[model samples]
Target: MTAKVALVTGATQGLGLALVEGLAARMSTEDTVYLTGRDAGRVAQAVEALPAGGARVRGEVLDVAGPHEAGRLAERLAERHGGVDIVFGNAVMRVGPEDDPREIVGAYAEVNNFGTTRLLRAFAPLLRDGGRFLVVASSFGTLNHLAPALHGRFDGLSSLDEVDKQVAVWRDAVADGSARGGDWPGFVNIPSKIGQVAAVRALAGERREADLARDILLAAVCPGMMNTPTSAMWWDVRDAPSPAQAAEVLLDLVFRPVDPAQYGGLVRDGEVLPWR
Candidate 1:
């Protein structure tokens, strides 16, 4: 049997790096895992530091926000390994309350929303049958934080068109300053995550037929609060789990058997959580 191929994005540090290490440790001799980040130097350092194993661990520079880069990576993976068996979309960007609203919104959408979509579009074709796609998501993205109407629209999404429409609404709100209004709550990171969660739901619904035919499973998971640099910027990290602990939970999901019933849902602490 051919060995499995796994890829983790934004894996130079924090939770992403820990995830790469966990995945690498679990791989068989024939398997290959690719660890990617935007910084070549960081990627090289990470690759060198990971524990050596029979499974080949390689590092590459990849910015998930770049569509061209995503496409190229997918193409290269196809050429070398036939297709990918698992993908962990872990790259993200966060902005503080003091930052300019426009910059915050743009960064969130570019890195979290569009970036996730681009990876899905580019790599969906390359995901082999019975493969898994996991997006690192957050509880902040849940419908509970969104306005009732916006929440309804997101919850009602059953296709990619609906998902696109919902994202456009948020984008428009951001442009018009309405996202900062009573209904939308103008936090820099939440809206971006909201868009990501909605897209995952829509993609799961839209791809249901294809997923069934191809045996592909798609899911979004929140690693809970982790004591990472990004989290330190906002919350007190003293109470949170270390990145390595969070990585263990994430890797568990990656290796578990696919369950059709859980498709398109948000998972936290190993259990499926209701989006609303």
Candidate 2:
């Protein structure tokens, strides 16, 4: 097998950090690893903190939402190593507590959706036939929204229309059909049709990061909920796993590709969790 270089964004903490550790544990020395984040200090710290691995670990400063970072990053790859083999688009902006549902909607679109689109556009040239591109999205982006599972309080989803409304009823436990949460529905289109259903079955938000990095065959791996600062907003789950353990899950996916259908993109409990 041909060895290659990988560039992972948001590698300072949480799930992003896991991707760093996992790749380090899995890749051989001939391969190169670049840990990135907007904060240069975090990047430097993460590089110093990496565990012993066959791959060489370096740090870079990158911002997923801003312009030029992607193109500039690609240029760096070209300068130092000639090309980049993998691009893990994991940089994300955090949301603060707010009542406005629209704010949450806008945040996800700009940060999660548009950010990925931008990076892909800038780095399209760097990715060769066998290069990999992974986006660390949430179940929120999928057809099901994983809304009912654990997104009860995520305001961005509260005002969605159509299909999302149907889900709210079952989740909110309405009394006397009075609609405990609201009179209107937040609509999102997941499981609305055959194609959507297929996508739901195929949505591998987190697992792809650790999988095979080839030309266009990108993969993802979900870190599930972890005990990092990212989970500061949600309080229901107790003592989520550490970034190190989460990294192990991703490493498993890299060394062994778990069928997306079987894993549902969120690998946990030594197996992939089934999407409802």
Candidate 3:
């Protein structure tokens, strides 16, 4: 039997590294898992630290936000593995309240939102039938974070184009100082995650037929409050779960059978939550 292939982005530390290790622990001699990070040295170090045993663990330098890198990585994976069996979209950027609003919003959107779309576009063709694409999202991404009007706009989105349009609206609001005027939260992270969930829903809906035909599944998941550098930098993580615990939840979903009803939905604590 051929070994399955898996890819995890931002695998240098925190949840990403934990997930890579957890997945590696479950693999057989034939399996291969790729660990990606912006820093080549870090990626190499991470790969070396994994106890993959007989399974092959490789490192790739990747900046998910880069325009050309995603495509290049996808092509390389295709040539090396024929196609990927699973993708864990875990790379993200966190912005604090004190940061410049415009820069935060732009950087978050580019990394968390557009970068995800770019990965999906580049890797979709390389995803074999019955493959899984999981986006690590957050509870804060729930539309309740926005005003009713904005909530409706985001919740009612039915396509990737609409999601892009909604993101553009938020970008415009940030640029014009309207995002601070009671209606918007003035924080970039929440909206960026909301865009991720929205994009998952839209992509799933648009690809429903293909998904069924190919047995492909897509989902957004919240790993809960973990004690990671990103969380520590922005909020209190004194009581948060360790990255290993969160990685277990993610790995459980990855190994379990796909549930069509939960496709394109948000999951937390191992339970699927309503998209709205």
**lDDT on C-alpha atoms for all candidate structures:** 0.81, 0.54, 0.82
TM, every model: 0.92, 0.64, 0.93
Sequence-dependent TM-score of model 3: 0.93
Model 1 lDDT, residue 164, Cα: 59
Predicted structure 1: lDDT: 0.81
**Which candidate tops TM-score?**
3
Residues 89-184, model 3: lDDT tens digits: 989876665788875677777788888877777876688877888899988778877667778767867877788788888877887777887577
Q: lDDT, candidate 1, residue 211?
A: 84
TM-score: which is higher, 2 or 3?
3
Ranked candidates, highest lDDT first: 3, 1, 2
Off by over 4 Å in 3: 52-54
Model 1: residue 202 alpha-carbon error in angstroms: 1.2
Worst 10 residues of 3 by lDDT: 48-57
What is the full ranking by TM-score, best candidate first?
A: 3, 1, 2
- Candidate 1 residue-wise lDDT at 150: 66
